[model samples]
Target: MAGNTEPLSPRAKLAVTAGKAAAAVSRAAGRGSGSVIGGRVALKLDPDLLGRLAQHLDVILVSATNGKTTTTRLIAEALRAAGPVVSNALGANMPAGITSALAGGSDAKFGVIEVDEKYLAGVARDTTPKAIALLNLSRDQLDRAAETRMMAEHWREGLSGSKAVVIANADDPLVVWAASSSANVVWVAAGQAWKDDAWSCPSCGGVMQRPGDDWFCGQCGFRRPAPSWALNGDYVLDPHGSAWPIHLQLPGRANKANAATSAAVAAVFGVPPQVALERMYQVQAVAGRYDVVTFQNRELRLLLAKNPAGWLETFSLIDPPPTPVILSVNARGADGTDTSWLWDVDYTQLAGHPIFVLGDRKLDLAVRLEVAGLDFRVCETLDEAVQYAPPGRIEVIANYTAFQDLRRRVGN
Candidate 1:
């Protein structure tokens, strides 16, 4: 499969030229936010650029509160078994970013793209993807529709407009509820560990009941659907009940869930289950999530913990006690402006571990640590912080911009 190479309309050609120029200037300025800027300017110049560019593309749109980036990357990697694939790597997930990615990868026939939770609908509607992968819904930004049920409603409406097969996490009630209305659905029991925002039924606002792993609503009688593709511990059981063993180079139960979801999505595109799993096994990291970078004579493994649910997953991967960990948090636009979400994180998971708080919002994390009654110290710089950890691997977990900054430092 190959992307359409036909010449663009005069309006689109002019828009692309201007957008490319803007991206070049932005990148030269070293701001690193140029990817979306170009797309924004392009879309402004030609409003229909996204739909125009999406023509003849076998697009897969993946959206969720967490794991969207990794899941998108995993699916994209698997799709390479089919043909050339295009995606906005490392979580550039917005309308502009999606446009920029499609524009740049003009010859890639298939696209596996990550989209922000709020923008999921527009992208799905525009691209009309071959398959839409729904991971899980969680309370990410309280300032911006922190109520995930509402976002689920938005997703339901958006997906209704899309002509795509929906591959959703059956274990996540929010995801199931949102995707249930879709005409074609493939359910995967990709486990949902974070249930803080899913206590109430999105349909009836009734209290939900969980009997073991299955959940049902008390008042409205909503319940978990039997999954077609399921993840049980170390194996992913297919629709025929054949289990395929999966071993990931990345350590974390969340990555296992991500791996299962990726394989499920790949199957929709005719990629064999075993072949998909093998391809996913090759991923050591998605951007900096599990990359080991040597900075100042110390090996630092970067984990991007953008929300409390994300923190919950990554904390389990941290080396217990003795080894020092550096946590960086920032209250930038990419990360929500309000940092109150810190209160929801179970910081006590690292109760006895030696933690070094870093970044501009290090003090905020320190306050949270103090409230949690955990022992922690402050580190001013990454190089100095690298000195504190003993000879083994040092873990550095940061949110959005902080993670992006450190990733750039490591790459440079």
Candidate 2:
């Protein structure tokens, strides 16, 4: 289905211009990137602005509890092999930010959007995207965001009967339930590391029987679909039984899963799997994530882990023992006011690493670590944490706001 290709009304054009001006003012004031404010202004002036801007572009929306930004970036890069692609590359996924990105990339052939999990359905409805990628669903922002099953229901209802080809993760039960209602779906075995949220079936509310990699609901028989794409150790196997080696600068098996999914989505737009993987190799990091920056004369690799599922994947990316891992967390509004999610993560895995904790909610993390029988030193600042650690490349894992704060301090 083609997007709304009608010309923008005079008011819409004026709204876009005004939004750009507001964004410029915001940048000058050093308040922020200005995408949100600018988009908000334009949206307030023209409620239908996003639709008008997206009319001519083949939009692709990506949503997940984790890896949304990175996957979006990878997809954008891979799609570029076909044509110019515009995206919210800075990790802004809200309506306003999405509007701003669309407005700026008027001439681009494709729109690759990283959408927040809560806003995916609305954004998808407005954009009428050609494709949508549902990565995974787990507990995130427990106090603010809807429950995982509720969110999955919303996705299923919102996407029902849509013409978009959904590229969904077959390993995540919640994702399977969400994309089941779509008209077209291409499943990928992206691998779910944390299955705490999917123990119960969304279809029948029955206990999910997970034996090895296959999951099925005994009551309703809702089981994992055979995937058209699968991720092997170092290769991605396609539906045609062709295995393509994935060589990415990004680390961890999670990223490899993301690459497999990206290749599947890109193929929907006519980009070959080999070409997509080749283009994806150029993306070293998404926003500030996985970017190694020099802080206090020491190299620190930044990894963002906001929830238990994300932490599980992040732990696999960090260097092994004696690397001095700095764990930071915050309870700010952006990080979710409730810090109770810390208890869900298994901190005992870091038992041998020299651990230092710092953030607004460091005490909560420290307590969790202490209960796990791990020793940790709480610090007031990243600088202090670096000072206390023995000299070497430091691995830093932080939540939402804490990661942003450290990224700014490191000037990346």
Best-fitting candidate, scored by lDDT? 2
True-structure RMSD for candidate 2: 1.0
**Could you give candidate 2's per-residue lDDT for residues 1-412 as a string of tens digits?**
3455777899999999999999999999988899999999999999999988998999999999999999999999999998999999998899999999999997788999999999999999899899999999999988999999999999999999899999999999999999999989999999999999999999999999999999999999999999999999999999899999999999999999999999999999999999999999999888889999888789999999999999999998888888899999999988899999999999888978999999988889999999999978999999999999987899999999999899888888
Please report, in order, the local distance difference test score of every candidate based on alpha carbons. Answer: 0.86, 0.94
Candidate 2 TM-score to native: 0.99
lDDT (Cα, tens digit) per residue for candidate 1, span 1-412: 3335566799987888888888899999986757789999999999999878887689899999889988998898788898889899857898898888888877787988899989988888788788999999888866775488888998988787466889999999999989988999999998888888889999999999988899999999999998999888999998989999887898888888888888988998889888888888778888778888888878888988888899999898988877778898988877887889999999998876678888888899999999999988888877667777667778889998899878887783
The estimated TM-scores of all candidates read 0.95, 0.99
Prediction RMSDs, each to the true structure: 1.9, 1.0
Best by TM-score: 2
Worst 10 residues of 2 by lDDT: 1-10
